[model samples]
Target: MLAIDETAAARAMIQISRVAKTYRTTDGEIPSLRPIDLSIADGEFVVVVGPSGCGKTTLLRMIAGLMPPSEGEIRVGDRIVTSPHSDVGIVFQSALLLPWRTVLANVMMPVEVKGLPREIYQPRAEALLKMAGLGGFETKHPWQLSGGMQQRVAICRALVHDPKILLMDEPFGALDAMTRERMNAELQRIQRETKKTALLITHSIPEAVFLADRIVVLSERPGAIAAIYTVDLPRPRQLDVLGMPEFVRLTTTIRAHFNAQLD
Candidate 1:
């Protein structure tokens, strides 16, 4: 677990001021996101959902500093994001684990790429695997694990570096329905345990409601914030919470936004 900085905890861990993205090609210019502002506080779990090509991934990529936004700026804590940031960790839809690397080796990839001593991060990587329920499977290959398990390994890899913020782009979108639901529960537990500021992009309304402290909904192409809903559910949420009236109400409300767009 990361030691909390008393002063840093007082401010939003991520701040976006009118951030937008556009793709420039010889053929034409394409706008993906409209200028929008959002702030994610320390340890908050925020989920972004929108129709396909609504720029959810684009927004997440900008926040991770993997790409630059054409408009405005993003700040992680006090630092402006101009290039890839050390304080952020990212996970995508695919596990993307190397075929030959052992699960533990895959988890430690970031630590190695950053040139951090393996001796120090080795135990941390092991501990993260254990936390993600892959303790005994460290020596196994990625192909040996189920899709859900592979995603768990990916999550462990992302956290192995002890990043202050976690950015996930449909991290479980490829899984079977049952597996995805299970992964959702596992993710909620992990996020709660680590208290890392998380921003996840998902297409599942139920998944969004299940994991988010707050949910940010985006509009159609050239996406902009449509609505932000506070989950208001109690902590340590279990799968049964999905059946609650409030959960149903929230999902229905959020679904309405997309439905309206279609009409």
Candidate 2:
């Protein structure tokens, strides 16, 4: 068993038990993800980084129950994740906002889909907008916003539903360097406030270092746990912290794995 921290005050939000995946292609069986055992403590933020096509998103899909693992089980709380559940919110690379809907309505999409009363959630939607720096843009359409702003709406939509777990699949991968950095800070602030248990997968080592409490790095294709690094940096992390020795050391360690694989 992987050693989980005993200092945690709450139960783990997600648990993976020797999980693995393989796909049957017309050509032959293809291996995707190798055995993975992980524990994400309640309200903790974890990130996964690996080479592209290394089964990073595959790991996330299995955890989210969007796709089933060929072996082993994933448990969210006491329930086995056989299918996607309401308690999980997902964000992908694309903002996926409705162009026709105003920012406010877009944020309310999940609430509406769940058949919850808008009156009860409208205030929350507004508050999320304010927190995302989109307060004044609430009435504007998605086209009026910049890439970062549109993603901010997507983040608000994810949180407006109040899901216990937030799963992100490189939600900022499309942005330029400057925008991505700003989004990272924005995400860190929002996550600190909400304290939702979050697991995100990205290819960027720096991003993984910036937002994660623990970062799990996967090996090449048929991804398996290569290493897991605990980010002991102080909370409410500022952008300037990236220049520190510890931050550089951590990123370097993770990069070494990929660098070695490429050579």
Q: Among these predicted structures, which one has the highest lDDT?
A: 1
lDDT of 2: 0.91
Per-residue lDDT, model 2, residue 119, is 88
Worst 10 residues of 1 by lDDT: 1-10
* Structural similarity to truth (TM-score) of each candidate: 0.95, 0.95
lDDT of 1 by residue, 1-263 (tens): 23454344348899898999999989899999999999899999999999999999999899988899999999899999999988888999999999899999999999989999899999999988898888899999999999999999999999988999999999999999999989999998898888899999999999999999999999999999999999998978889999999999999999999999999
Candidate 1: clashing residue pairs, number: 0
Candidate 2 residue 140 C-alpha distance from true site, Å: 1.2
| Candidate 1 collision pairs | none
Each prediction's whole-model lDDT (CA):
0.93, 0.91
